[model samples]
Target chain A: MSTDTAEKYHKHTPAPIDCNNVVISLRNIRKSFGSLEVLKGVDLDVCKGENVVVLGRSGSGKSVLIKIIAALLRPDEGTVRVLGKEIDQLDARELQELRSKIGFSFQGSALYDGMTVRANLEFPLVRNQRKLTRQEVDKAIRQVLDDVGLSRTIDQMPAELSGGQKKRIGIARTLILHPEIMLYDEPTAGLDPVTSVEINDLINDVQQRYNTSAVIITHDLTCAKATGERLVILSEGKFLRQGSFEEVFHNDDPIIKDFYNYNFISDS
Target chain B: MKVFFLRIYDIYQFSLRFWKEAFLPPYEYKEVFNQFFEVGIKSLSIISLTGFITGLVFTKQSRSSLAEFGATSWLPSLMAIALLRALAPLVTALIIAGKVGSNIGAEIGSMRVTEQIEAMEVSSTNPFKFLVVSRVLATTCIVPVLAIYMGFIGLLGAFVNVYNNEQTSFVSFFQEAFMKITFLDLFTLVLKSAIYGYTIGMAGCFNGYYADQGTVGVGRAANTAVVVSMFLIFIEEMLIVTLINTYR
Candidate 1:
């Protein structure tokens, strides 16, 4: 989205990429519910083993974009390809298999409150990997919990876990499947500053450990700075600017400058 | 009218989808059993209590009318037929429509509002099998048994109410109650109970699974589920009755 005076903002927008190495790709994605357009011909790609953060205001449709990659929502126009498979071309079973390779952490964590931590962690494997033995299941659970540092919460329910712990357990459950692409929706939205940083670190840690390509959707500047290898700002249902944090943060676009200035004020 | 038809079509498709998924591999019997225990076994106290009260009041009311006609001896047969052919199943289903229907609605509705259902789908699990099929199948399986139990319990209540003064024996009471139930009557009643059970389960699951995303939406779903299921029960029973009457 280039305007006559928007040269600085447009300068940092990403260049075109070779499609073969892309882990997730969207082309001219246009979606609308009723008369409101959410994504207007937006195109993005996440390379293998890279973290891209999408920053947007509330109601800017960041969550919808995240959902599109996971095939949780379909765009009225354009294409979504994840893990090299065209999403709309797959049948139900094939789509499910594709979904298993992608882990989505929702805004509220969305852990199954009916189940305990162990059951929540075990749910994906039990439902999908039916051939896993009991010992194997237990080992997988232990390994993931140990990885997330939540081993003792095995018997506890989601209601009992604090917000930070719930988010971790949510990630743990998704991680149990060893997904190749992780979609994080507001991973650090509601936590205190310290816990938010911790979750941000955890996101980075999980990305490196699992070798996952991730799309982190958040408004938290600290999170965007910490976890994102690349950042794209969504405004007016389009990618307004893209670059590293330093590049976009220092650029003199009025909209970009005002966003950083306001958030920086809030931070202090 | 169009919206009503669309809603009906949606429910029909949902039921068919459940049937399709139910017979496939990876059937979740544990989930089915849990829902059965929740929808049927757990509802016994309410069903039994209603059965007793219905039988008592029904027999007493019929006796008063029969006494005026000098036909009080017909009490046992009349009550027996009414309870077996209609009361037992209808009452049990209505109770379910209120208790279990609302519960199913709330459970699924809350999950939908909270995004647990979406998470399950994204995790590659079929929530239809884990959630809807089990609830629907459980009701279809367990409701008929519950209706039969209710019929027997109603008879016990009638016998207790008829005894001491009228002096009807336990053996005679059951004998008369059951003997009057012809095969056609039995079939119709069982068929009606099964249909009622399916309607209640489908209504609840449909409303719950399709509920909009909010706390208010959950409440609306539960309320709407009970009302719609009760309305369908009455309509279905009327249709079944008219068909049976014409057949006779």
Candidate 2:
């Protein structure tokens, strides 16, 4: 994949990883909120440069799973290792260090409302990598905005942008850090169909361009189908199946059939 | 009742976390200055107006009583003692508790509900240090300064009343006012204002940081921040006055 943004911005090579090496590994993860068991013994892994999409309905604990992987939430029972370090064992400073290499794109885009697009993108870079000069920061911001195709919205606040534009900027903000892994929570949750497709294309574009491993959590079938190199269906706090989109859905189980019917019916 | 106690305990824990994070390096100086601008500069007009009105009204009301006793000459000294020792700091704090407290609550609450806090965390930015510490430190540092300003403005308002009634000169009015005010009174004013500022900042940050249930949570956070800060401010005022009185 040709990365015009990477070439135009300051060029630096990412640390090499074997293509088959797993960057994110989760085993027997369990989480509960009060009386509700949100995630019950789940396990998953993603190799370097792979886009693994976890498809689940609302309240299926897909978000919890990702948060655990990011160490935002502690698992009740499990081991979560990201980029070769055990997430739970790392102290605050170590966790922060680890998190710098992982970019999380929130469900609502989560751009800072008080900041302009440029400041929003600059925030992570300036905070995490404090040595970058002003010109370097501006150049990187321009490159990511260009990559996300919203260079014109640099001066606008998050509220001024359309939903699609906000999503692009959110991705662009995460990409600015040059993360080794991207965790996207519902990248196309509330956009129009056309916009959803555009976001899916952007997700794929980011994966190819940045060569970052990713875990995309969403129930949107089109998004899963379009961006997921491997797809897993999360149901009742556990993964029901994992494979290619077609393989996962090709089942006689009532649950799988129901999921397919619901999505297909809704899409149609 | 159990839930209430739990909430208090949570707030206590949250305050401890703030102290721990506050001393850590990478101090977010830019954000602290921004919050100072927000808390101090933006709030100047309202604080000034409130201070002036308080001084004017309190003096006006007290004048009839003083005249009844033929002690009208004591008005400047009495007004000075009242405004500097109590009214200025308490009223300024309550106003700020309402204004800046609610703002911090709603802003951080909205950020919490929308996952912007989580976004900050994932980006390797300490959201608590960036958001809570900066606002709390700003309020802690600025509220004392504001209270002192209010005290001065209130005296000016009292002077206006004194001048109108007795043709007193500005210097004489001020001299009379300061006659009864001890260094202890000034110290109490500063201490009380700082405590109230800390209370307001902590209440707002705690409610907002832990806000839930989406938009409704944001509104609740803002409302709770004001009520709790005001309640705590009153309690703090009473305790500090009691303690300072013993010293006198």
DockQ of each: 0.81, 0.94
Quote the lDDT for A134 in model 2: 98
The DockQ value obtained for model 1 is 0.81
**Candidate 2, residues B18-44: lDDT per residue as tens digits?**
999999989999999999999999999
Clash number for every model? 0, 0
Window of ten residues with lowest summed lDDT in model 1 chain A: A1-10
The candidate scoring highest on TM-score is: 2
Q: Model 2 in CAPRI terms: which quality?
A: high
lDDT of 1 by residue, B217-244 (tens): 9999999989999999999999999999
* TM-score for the A-chain in each candidate structure: 0.91, 0.91
Colliding residue pairs in candidate 1: none
